[model samples]
Target: MIRAVAFDVGETLVRDDRYWTSWADWLGAPRHTVAALVGAVVAQGRDNADALKLIRPGIDIATQYAAREAAGRGEYLDESDLYEDVRPALAALYAQGVRVVIAGNQTARAGELLRALDLPADVIATSGEWGTAKPSAEFFARVVDAAQTEPGETLYVGDHPANDIVPARSAGLRTAHLRRGPWGYLWADTAEAAAADWRIDSLHDLTQIVSGAG
Candidate 1:
């Protein structure tokens, strides 16, 4: 049985339309252009941030990030950014006496915004705050540590197969691939995705998973 559930932020719990759209505007590129570039980069097995670099070669992402903030345009999150099933599903798990954690590749400020929402979770952590990011063994180690459970008894859920499923599985945790986002749908039919302990269309599906129906 799964004793704890840890969720990815973007495209898993939260839809990232706002993030890419804001980047397009800030980068002075067409929204569709940026979106297409993002897809292209991801398809090439390149990081999505490379799309921004493709828009402006030699762009220093960290510096540009600060510039965007100084210009009154920066990362922002609210209830509306979340997927519809996030609260109910997480709340149900928490009420069922399972530990709920939200851990993902996100900025420190994103972590603050997530906590501000006051979601029913035992912990909400970001790569920036932890000084490590996913696909790294250290990152998954921190995730299992935060869950306070044996790796096999913990579940790591995310839309990205490479970052979420593969690394988590390598770290000895059970994995769930969510087929709800772009990267998810793109690779859902692949063998890597099939290797996950479970494939879910929604967080609501997890209740049954933890209950042993999976």
Candidate 2:
């Protein structure tokens, strides 16, 4: 029986591609170029922060784009804005009595993002705070501890196979791979081929997965 469900915030629960795309457009570069740059940095075995540093030159251009949006009185480009797109889905899980927790890596601005999205204060657990990142057993262990549930009793849903599924599985948590785009090779085939404990195409499918687990 699943007692708790932890989520990867970026791309899994929320869509952050828009931010990256917007940044790319502002820099007058192909979106794929920016993504490729990010991929290369991460491939070097750098942490998210280190990867960001490698991409900072590009990110500064993106920040300038955000500034332009802010000047135009457009919706502010906030990291938390990603969560707004998935609030209803999250609320649905909460209504179903699932204890939802976020296990992510972020800069110190994470709290600001959460507040901006009006996310409840209790559901977040981050690498910045925990001093560890995914694919690390210690990171998932903190999530298991925070959720107050044993590994076998929890389900971890994430977008990345290496960062999300592999680590959670290592921690003995049931894994769900959220099929979105070309983010991972696991999604290149079908969800079944990915071999996650569960595969979901949308957040709406999560409740049914949990209910069926019982």
The numbered model that scores best in TM-score is: 1
Q: Which residue pairs show collisions in model 1?
A: none
lDDT of 2 by residue, 131-212 (tens): 8877789988998987788999888888777788877887899988877644544343554327678777776777778888
Q: How close is candidate 2 to the true structure, as a TM-score?
A: 0.72
| Per-residue accuracy of model 1 over 67-112 as CA lDDT, tens digit each | 9889889999999999999999999999888899999999998999
The 10-residue segment of model 1 with minimum total lDDT is 205-214
Q: What is the lDDT of candidate 2?
A: 0.67
Q: Candidate 1 versus the native: TM-score?
A: 0.98
User: Positional deviation of 116 in candidate 1, in angstroms?
Assistant: 0.7
Cα deviation in Å at residue 88, candidate 2?
1.7
Instruction: Quote the RMSD, in angstroms, for model 1.
Output: 0.7
RMSD of each: 0.7, 5.2
> Candidate 1 — what's its lDDT?
0.95
- Go through the candidates in order and give each one's C-alpha lDDT: 0.95, 0.67
